[model samples]
Target chain A: MTSPARQLRGKDERAPVALSDRAMDNLRFIRETMERSASFTHVSGIGGVAMGLVAVAAAWAASRTTSDGAWLSIWLGAAGASFALSAFLMGRKSRAEGVALLSGPGRRFAWSMTPALAAGGVLTAALARGGHFGLLPGTWLLLYGASIVTGGSHSVRPVPVMGMAFMLAGVAALASPPAWGDAYMAAAFGGLHVVFGLLIWRKHGG
Target chain B: MAASSGAVRRRSLEPAERAPGNLDAVHGRTQESGPLELDQLIHERVRLGIVSALAVNGSLTFTDLRDLLGTTDGNLSAHARRLEDAGYVACKKSFDGRTPRTEYGLTEVGKRALNAYLDHMEAIIDATRE
Candidate 1:
């Protein structure tokens, strides 16, 4: 079916000089160029899968730890390691693709995502200070998901979808018993990452 | 000359439908033309593409812009030179090792022009829909 714009264009032979179908075409071209420029296209799919693997390992290690401190330490270490690995991989991919890592859309993406992550850091300290160990996983997932959702607005399509999945898992973790926290982390961080990572890899390329 | 001026005034006042071919009749020559009239400079396809792409990007290398637009080197060069001359675009030339790199960016004047152009197009769409 022809669009409303097309219909409008077709309705008038008398109005050809101004406000023609050519104007619509120009608008479409400009809109498309802006959208492409705004999209953060440097997300590393392989990095995502590798991060998931690290999360899975961290979850296993956390489960084996008898003390809450040790569990937190294990997960924190994993988080840092995962971040470094993802940064390295994403940088490599961006270089290979000839897209600057910290310019244009990438800069916008980082700006959008930074606030939630900063809040997460602040809240993590606050919660741990209060001995609220069980709440950590839920808080982490929720904030991380929020970051992804906000930043993913400037990223490829699937990034936001993955953010939504993380959010659902966060909600589930919050509702379930504290003993089930690690499992939820496994499912959301590990499983979702691998699934979406593979999909992004195949679709957007590694 | 007096009779000719009178005829021109009369034609300008005539209904737009009666003078479809006459732009000056439908949208008369004025100190400030409304949004229905498109900016002639950015109206062309290739030039419009260059401006639109530069609007969102911080800067783009000549090679990058050519690849993005899918245009040949000479064609891109000619259009880019036009924009550069219009003060709507800025060009920077530098060397990356042995290779010389030419980068292009949109100027502030260009940004305002593009914004005005976009406003005009949007106004057209809104008018059409109505």
Candidate 2:
């Protein structure tokens, strides 16, 4: 049986380019592949780790009872695992540079999101601790959106605009407390992350 | 796998006609001009590493090249052997201590070959640029 790597390398060697065609078509494919490779796990990891940490924190902040911590622990583990799996897969792709690195910019591009995610997390933690139940969720959404937009890859469509929208919504929530603050937060950060992360992750497998 | 250092040594007996760095590639192209020079060489990553490392530094120890190239001992040795057969690089063994070690280098011919390969790439880019 032929080795899978051998087959892939052979295909890579044989993959045609139009010698006379002055075509940079392969450049887009390379960039898209690289962008998807870097963004999926990194974005997922951020969302996953953030979700896990917040769930546990929120649960503790909500109840005086230990049961809340236990409940929170479940979410932390689930999200953490998803983050880890994505991270591992992304690492594997890095070894094949012709296939991945030449394609996209990198995960560090996603790392630029620190200001937004951190700002959101800190605000949420403070709100939860202070018993300001209404603001905690809104803060998370705003921050999540802001971070994703700031740190997200250029290759992905609509990430920056969506992030801007979330920041705007967050400002609105703070200006006037609303009944749907939590939902908005989830929509901005958690929902957007899960949605985009899943889209990128699915592309990796297929 | 064939240790045909003799072929490479004999080829290098003719004093190299190319300029040291940039035009070495151009002169190399004129010599081969067709598809025959690198026919046996596959231009794989590890081999690229060996060729690249040799091009920059005229010689390297097997351990040094292994470290620079980031490959397992067997993997480095295998790729080095292929390049050696193609007359693109040369490796020789010596004692580092009680243990044995190997050293490799790009011969003048190998340097000419790498220059030729790079010239080909630059030509492609130059063609696209215009």
Candidate 3:
């Protein structure tokens, strides 16, 4: 059995390990709560840059095409490539950050963004079939922006702002002459992506 | 007959004696009564951090928890083991290709305990303010 003096000394030794005051504990609790509930922080800046480059390339390729069919095909191909690149880069970044690909925030972002993308796909096919190709750029930008804004609500702050920018570009593309469609696409997708991607990269780290 | 009667009396009296202690245990403060009995297991900073993180993420790998909690491998392992032993957390071992990976998630008991702990702390804060 321990002596009373030894027990008293033991208690004294252990005193420092005790929980901190109420304020500190509350602060810690609040912080942990936020960390748990917040969206995944692994949105890939490099992925955005890659997507931007691909958009620039697609714009260049589409501009060289004389027929509407060829232009549509080129842009569609670019879309597929962008999707693949984004998935690959996001996967890499998520792994590096130890965030699951299907984490709560990730799932939320996908769910919110997927509908807009799906709508864009349907609208693209319909617009192309109807020979309303001039409106295609504006439609794509608007829908893509909508998706981003909706989805980015669940992502980091800049994402939604980028989405809003895309939406505005879509409106301008619609107001401009049909001849300016591809230029608008190039500007919004290529320019905005590179700019925002750089910002996210610099501010949020890789 | 007398001996059996005394045993029954003690058994009946046990709960009455234990009732106030239980209240003290839940409140985790004893200035007005006896001593507070906070769950010492989770009161420690590192252990609480680990548990709190797990409570939110649903599951986390050993490396994930280590990075999140900023703890060394050995320290995390020891605390995780203690929580595991208490049935407050569950651990699963698997392989990612050739590499072995260990993942942890809070068990039901842990979730309930964490909720109770939070509520108790809030109560303490409320009482102190009052």
Candidate 4:
């Protein structure tokens, strides 16, 4: 389904110019901005607790099985480290800064990264065992983006646009069949993440 | 223009949206060009916060309102004046020996305005449901 966040933006502009003076426009802008901020940042990011759980599970999974592939174990360790560190930084930012970390751009990034990271880990394992590594990363991105957009929009987050855009590119990549799935996954997770994270930091710095 | 006229050297910041129904129509015309309207009374954010909080809490002291909304003394005092002017809330100031104290609660009029606002919200939801 089309997202509510997109609908809100379109619905806003469709209102007649004759409705009120420029003053009305200004008020609407302020109110909508506030509402969207509250939805994306304050309400939607309540999943930091779940992210904490993922960190624990990754650490435990890495510990329990010595026969697991060494590289796979390392990847799981990195996932655990990154998730714990992100959650820690976010938690500190939320409490100290009074602006919740799990909300807004941070939350959006976390949501997008989760499925991509998971699929990447799985695909890396499967590819090492001799299989076509074409559709995994793209599928991960497409699904992750669509999920974030769907979940975030109900609460009025604007960050889902970023997710949707990345997902669309992922769709194109998969349809055209990229030469390497790992490269595509790296682009979606590492490159796209660094870029969007920097953008968010610039716009709303810690 | 009127909300920030000479009497109150404010930043020309007109607060947006009152109780969202007939109350808004009354405030719109009056705030534009007429005597100060009662609908304009609790529209300011701080005052509205005070009212909404009190509506939930029954009563709040001056310090309580200040702590809840994080407004400075002078900032809250100015907005409280508007509410008081319209008799939306009854503010009582007192002194126990040396320290100062103040308590505020919704007046009959304030209760009615809050009720009207809730009713307006219910009507909108009901209409959407239909």
In terms of lDDT, the best-performing candidate is: 1
Q: For residue A129, give model 3's deviation from the true position in Å.
A: 0.9
Candidate 1 vs candidate 2: the DockQ winner is 1
Q: lDDT scores for all predictions?
A: 0.78, 0.50, 0.76, 0.52
- For candidate 1, state the interface root-mean-square deviation in angstroms to 1 decimal: 7.5
**Deviation (Å) of A37 in candidate 2:** 15
lDDT of 2 by residue, A105-139 (tens): 44455466767666766775676578675665556
True contacts kept of each: 0.49, 0.00, 0.02, 0.00
Q: List candidate 4 segments past 4 Å from native.
A: A1-37, A42-79, A99-133, A154-158, A176-179, B1-130
* Residue B109 lDDT in candidate 3: 91
Residue pairs that clash (backbone atoms under 3 angstroms), model 4? none
- Expressed as tens digits, the lDDT of each residue in B20-121 for candidate 3 is 123242223444765444465765666777778887666788987787778899999999999999999999999999999999998999888777667656
**Model 2: lDDT of residue A84:** 69
Candidate 3 off by > 4 Å = A1-36, B1-130
Write one digit per residue (lDDT tens) for candidate 4, span B1-130. 2222222212222233532213222212334553322344544567667777666444568887786678899998888877878888899898968989998888889888766544433332332222
- Candidates in order, TM-scores: namely 0.56, 0.38, 0.57, 0.37
Interface RMSD of each: 7.5, 14.2, 12.2, 12.4
- Measured against the true two-chain complex, the DockQ scores of the candidates, in the order shown, are 0.20, 0.02, 0.03, 0.03
After superposing all C-alphas onto the true structure, candidate 2 shows an RMSD in angstroms of 18.1
